[model samples]
Target: MSFEELPHQADVRVRVRAEDCNVLFAEAARAMFSIMYVTCDEGEIERRVSVTSDDMQSLLIDFLSELLFVSEVDRVVFSSFDVVITGTSLTATARGEPFNPAKHLGGMEVKGVSYSGLTITRDGEGFCSEILFDV
Candidate 1:
């Protein structure tokens, strides 16, 4: 799985490519956290998250949104995800630790995931997704 930051006018955009749906979702989460400069070196906590949407794109948005909410409320940053996607539903175990200001450098504050320019499609034998984040 791999992801790269794309140029955006006011927000942050990321393009991700993976071997399948599950890896795509995991890579997207990593890209989002990377944008925020969040790193979980020594995981001290684990959270299970599940989300269902009408489609894969929506499911991805909801999944990431849940992570963002958890980060905000629990004051933690997740760096690893074991994501499973079946149809329009997603379930995953996220691992991370509490956000320590001294260790985790704060980057751009992502407000929410956006639907603009969002795309998820099959590319050859794998899958690719593009997401825009509101910063």
Candidate 2:
């Protein structure tokens, strides 16, 4: 799994490449957390997330949005993700610890995930996706 931040006017953009759909989802979550400067001490919390959508794009959006909500509500930052995708549904196991402002350096605040410039495609034996985040 790999991802790189792309230039955007005001929001944050990222391009993620992975060996398959599941890896792609996990990497995208990692990339978002990295961008937000979210750091966790250890896996003190584990949450399971399940979402269903009409298509891959919607599924990705819903998955990320759910993570953002979890971060805000639980006051934690996720560091690990185990994801399984089947058709338009996704189930994930997320692991992290409670957010400690004293220990973690905060980065940019992402307002939400955006659909602008979103794309997912097959690349060789892998997959690549581009996502835009509203900051």
Question: How badly does each model clash, as a count of residue pairs?
Answer: 0, 0
Could you give candidate 2's per-residue lDDT for residues 1-135 as a string of tens digits?
Answer: 399988888888999999999999999999988888655545679999999999999999999999999988988888889999999999999988888787668677778988878999998999999999987
Q: How high is each candidate's TM-score?
A: 0.94, 0.94
lDDT score, candidate 2 = 0.89
Q: Show where candidate 2 strays beyond 4 Å.
A: 38-42
RMSD of each: 1.3, 1.3
Worst 10 residues of 2 by lDDT: 35-44
